[model samples]
Target: MTIPTDATPSGLGGSEPAVLSFQDLEVQFATDLGEVRAVNGISMEVHPGEVLAVVGESGSGKSVTSMTALGLLPKNARIGGVVRVTEKDVRQLDARRLRQMRGKDVAMVFQEPQTALNPVLTIGDQLVEALQLHGVAYGNAAKRRAADLLAAVGIPEPARRLKQYPHELSGGQRQRVVIAMALSCDPKVIIADEPTTALDVTVQADILDLLRSLKEKLNTGILLITHNMGVVADMADRVAVMYQGDVVEVGSAEQVLVYPQHEYTRRLLDAVPRLGAGRAQLGIAAEAPPIITDEVPALEVKNAVVEYHRLGKPSFRAAEDVSFTVHQGEIVGLVGESGSGKSTMAKCALGILPPTSGTVAVYGEDFNRLKRKDRKALQKRIGVVFQDPAASLNPRVPVGDIIAEPMVIHKVGTKTERQRRVYELLEAVELPRAAFNRFPHELSGGQRQRVSIARALSLDPELLVADEPTSALDVSVQASVLKMFMTLQAEFRFACLFVSHDLAVIDMLAHHVVVMENGRVVEQGLREQVLHEPREEYTKRLLAAAPVPNPEEQRRRREQRHAMLAAFGDKVVEIGDVPHGPEGP
Candidate 1:
């Protein structure tokens, strides 16, 4: 089923030619070991007023191909074949001519807005600079145009936002600012590289809507690079699937996504977590036999309230009166959007933050009331998995040492015994023995996450707090990690508090669900009850906003969501005027 859009081919007039094209493109990077071919001979084109999605996992040459079109490749890289923008060959152009074509003829929207935007400059300064760089506008004219761009992207109070820096905005707002900057020069083509990968579902839906509207209004061609099949289903008119430097499949969005002919494409589709699929269908084991327990729960948080004090203003309540329980062998999912206090709740559970008003108990013992030495001893019974393994793992340490560090800290074993345990943990996580000597930088994202998992389990903790552990991974990798997590939980009978914004993932693995909104739990019950028969309007909104890989279903869901919002007189959620500091909510 295809999600129909109102977009029509009218960008720069219907008489215009293709905005971007690639023919027999080949790219290679010269390295000390050998010459590595990144992109094999491949061909594709993007016309004005259409979105052409390039979908693949990491190392599939998706980004490299798009980078070549922008002339952003390194000097040492060898490029072959033709890359054209509006009939002009980008390869034949010199540095100055290429610079002129970059913002005027083509522009790019990056995956991470924080890195793409300058931290020191105001949004107005950056947007105006982009316009002036292409000789589109300057001075008062540039400011006015910048404000217009911001308003066009659906950001409220465009004029006031110009004075704010990138850090002052939320993740969704930052991304909108990036899109506004891309439109400053009215380029014919926009290359969006994983634009919504790090965003929440509602925010992603809003961004996709804005892009579709822009395509219809301006007729700008879009080259969308992403690995998410749902995104392709929602946005693309045509699809190109890449695998290990080759174009494995190409067709219309409906044809490619629903009736994919290639084996690789089918595997990608199979790896996606469907909302209603049971554990067996998703490659996870059924719930383990209920753990025999006395009266004590594995973990408990009662009337928890966390606050952040301010120097000159009222304190902020991050988590208010939140309460939940994770029984032994149970996985309770905490679901919410960004700034919804999910992380704050996780921190409170981990005892990293002391709640101001309530108690956190582990196996019936109050965590905050324990003595210093007793608290240290209790910590050995708890494990944690952060969102980004690269940030959590020490870069300089070997995988073996990293895994063994927890044991070493708790004085669990000798050097030789710890070394043997490292190899055992590696095998348990399905990693090779050689990985024991590799550094974090030497491994893939999935491998690093596995290593983090192994390290977390090294202490053999009774409870685990996994916060968005699979959010950054590709679909296939995420599936494998989740399956492994389920298997390990079954084997060890350890309780878990899994926090994420992905309802599909939660539906696949969780026994109970807790829905959060603005630092409070709006709903909590068994998964079957909360997900299937949601009682709160906010939970229904979240379920409605989630995009399915089926285009027709997603379109239907979008329409229903819009109608629901209208009925309630509720506006689309936007980044509010919260104070932007180093600390997060």
Candidate 2:
């Protein structure tokens, strides 16, 4: 059940209200420009036993405001607000007292578990100390609770996993462990900051359901921060739309999501790429004519099969009969779900892993049978863009030098020539000259991606291999980047192999579509043929699962639920039987 939004802002001090409320909150950071109001005057309340979703794009103060409530901001940061929790005003609380309250009264599950979790500590030790410090029973009590919490979060074989390190667990399992830790204290409030931002769709659905159920069962309030409206629609009881650090819209989930009143909210929703719906074209459009021949494709893969061989063991087939091509000046979109071996096919084309059989030829030169000099020459004509630009870029070096490195390595021109080219490349990526001097950490996620693109273009490659280039960016920024890619291809006439999990993006950028599943291509044809006129069950499932632009899709789900219950009589179906549930078969 949702809390009453019109509830008066009860004064903080004497007694605790439902839970952690931010009244007239304002957070600012001192910079050369001045005190940047990161979080403008905003008021929000997360009552006990409800999921309050805070939705916004980058620079929207979603993170900053949540960080303030937990007293997690830096010392230099100026915060003006009243944060109430555990019958105490947290904003004015002393450091030691606030420290005592955290992980007991409240806890947070961060976005990147790898970065948040201490790499050196084993999972058991981390959980044990976290529980013991909070005085949530000692020794075996804490261990037993930790194991139970793990299983509660759907982690398999908790006892065995306790000894395993963070690195040993996959991304999804690590997220589960993080969730387990969040619930260890049985905190009154849980702040999950973009908790499912990096997970796969199906995994994301599972995590959402897990959190929703946990919130209900434990009577814990949740301040869910995310940019995805689909996710917000699924789990939020109430939604607070933040723009320019201010809460522009705050209302029940049904009201805000179904009939968004604010222009900004509408724009934000509009910016979301509807994977199954959009333009009728291959979805990808080019401004200029393609620069390839009809006789031989720019890059051709013929019945390519790649295997990973371990000593004294049978080799595993990484990619089976994967065949596709990247024609010059045209884009080929390869779409798939997570763990579908999309990356393996990319690696094979890059020659990082040679295919066990079949042929890969670029511009009439065979890649598998090529020598070092020949392969190096081929590298000059192919560029790759990974999902996480921050990880790919060198932290120590500036953007200009990073971009110029590719040109310098290939010995394209003189020193002055290289410097001029770097400037031009930065300009092409729509980044300011000042960005040339800043390191990767100094820039935002979108800017870092632009730098990565600039570097990839420095070598003037004939083909670009982009893997989830826009997945990390905000929708508005993602759209702009897609347009930029189109413009770049039009100008340079370079072919692109765009790889993405989101079908809407693939449709908008790909001239043709190749759907991959279980390390093999299930469908490959014109974008319209593959996306709109599907011939496979998996393709239909992908389309049905795509993010809906309007709230009508939400209605469809409700109606579907109603129809299912109507047909199945009054017998209860397991929670896992629900479409978005864990066992959604």
Candidate 3:
């Protein structure tokens, strides 16, 4: 908890001049409901060669506060107080000067790189455009600088990558490209907003390392905005905790994260899922009774092999010889990094993707062999929850109808009966009955995910396949959803195939664990055997890469992971090595 003062570089402890500073800042929006206060009177500073992380939940003004520096807020937004960058007040800048200062004096790295970059443009084109916008370079000179920037960010084959489109690059690569663009003009201050949220653990670690190195090399101040405590622990030299549009706490990383003075900060840290903490520590109830009788397993996948055939390339196996099982009243966790075939296995089990070889059985019946009618009948007993509920739920449909669609398809009840079931489902998910009339967009991310869960369970299916259900949610929202899921599983006693990249969540919910890599099952066994005493080097690497909330522990883990990767050499699985399948590779 006590980080040595010497751990940070000299002159980084408030003695240096600030590159960016906010004084008595406040932001308000004019909405249909009324005037909404997004950011209250807040003051902070980002000093040269230091990371000042702003940690908060969604809608806590983290992004809004950062965006104000660039004048990125909507025209209708009302702002007050002073925001200074390099001794110049941003609010006082004209349109022309603001545009010039944006990428030159201050740059931003967005959360999702896919949306941040122009999809139609090549990576080189985007980088060149950024440089040319600030009058840094143009034409052949810009192209050369573009490739150099890519190389500086540790990307391989920089020139060839420049020729490729954004879609061609992996998530990690795209993020690096975004970082490259941000570095095109060598800005004095960088605002990174949830930079690694969509990445896998190994990729996240690499991105954090890249950011840290960039800060040191450029001596640029960084204002990091994120909801992830692990990211804050790993990157921040100082921490500021925001709650309900207010800065509730601010101190050194060790002081705030380890010995928080505010209750909100402590609660935020507690919401994080700690590695090896187990379900009891997270307040999850005991596991449901075992379904160990001599009966058919709830779901069984045997030596399954699934392949995708590209138009001009040779067919590749997405899942090769993968096998696992989930008994009634049990939860089997499918976990791995990106392109590890975890979701491919889940899809094969859900009968959404037919295997090239081997078999998938549901309640002792071969799913591939079932007739159309029989398959439809079998589907009535299955439910699924995907990662992004906003994408999964129909925005045009009401919540009640979405939940009742399953009953209607199966012709199991009359209209009145369906309405009753809808209410029951709403209650089961702990949603207000008034939500029945609301659309998916009208609710928060966590609320929409709960609605998705309610719809999935509407049919009272005996089996459920959840694919990274909590990955997109905030930590506190995720905790509530997880608790609800566990409670539902205990009540219904349905078998579950839970797919996720988060090891802490997997450890909490899964009775059995299955680890995959490059479409192959590297390890599978009871949770205690696989998690507590992992034998596979791959599993060890994964465990080592997962960040803890404690800054000191996370620092040690990072060092250990670096050493392990060094020892393993080329054996580690690189990101974007294979195409992620429908469920994800």
TM for every model, in the order presented, reads 0.88, 0.84, 0.88
Regions of model 1 farther than 4 Å from truth: 1-16, 291-295, 365-367, 389-458, 571-585
RMSD of each: 5.6, 5.8, 5.9
Error of 2 at 548 (Å): 2.2
lDDT at 585 for candidate 1? 15
lDDT values for all models: 0.83, 0.74, 0.83
Candidate 3 structure quality by residue, lDDT tens digits, 1-585 = 222334344667457667888888999999676998999988888888899899877678888899999988888799999999888899999889899889888999997788789999999989888877777777887887888888888789999999999888877899999988888887889999989877777778888888888777677799998777888898999888888888888888888899999988888888888878766757875544566546799988889899988899999899999888899998999888878887788888778889999989999878778999999988889999876676688999999999898899999889999999999989876679988999987675567878888888889889999987876667886787788788878888899999887888888888999999999999999888898899999899788878888899889988788788889883322222111111111
Q: For candidate 2, lDDT tens digit of each residue in 1-585?
A: 123456322321113355778888888888666787888778878777778888877778888888876788876689886878757788877889887788878889997777778889988889878877766757776667677767777777989888889987866788888988887776789999888766655456557767877766666788998877777877777788888888888777777888899998887777776665544323345334554767567678889888888889998786789888878777888877766677777776676767789887777778767899988888898888877776789899988788888778788999899988988878776778888788887776667878888788888778788877776666666666677787777788888888786777886777788888888999889887998889986675555445444445754753454354456462211112111101110
What's the lDDT for residue 501 in model 2?
A: 69
List the lowest-lDDT window of 10 residues for candidate 2: 576-585
Give per-residue lDDT, candidate 1, residue 329. Answer: 88
Rank list by TM-score = 3, 1, 2
Name the 10 consecutive residues with the lowest summed lDDT in model 1.
576-585
lDDT of 1 by residue, 395-456 (tens): 99999999999999999989999999999989877678989988997676657878888898
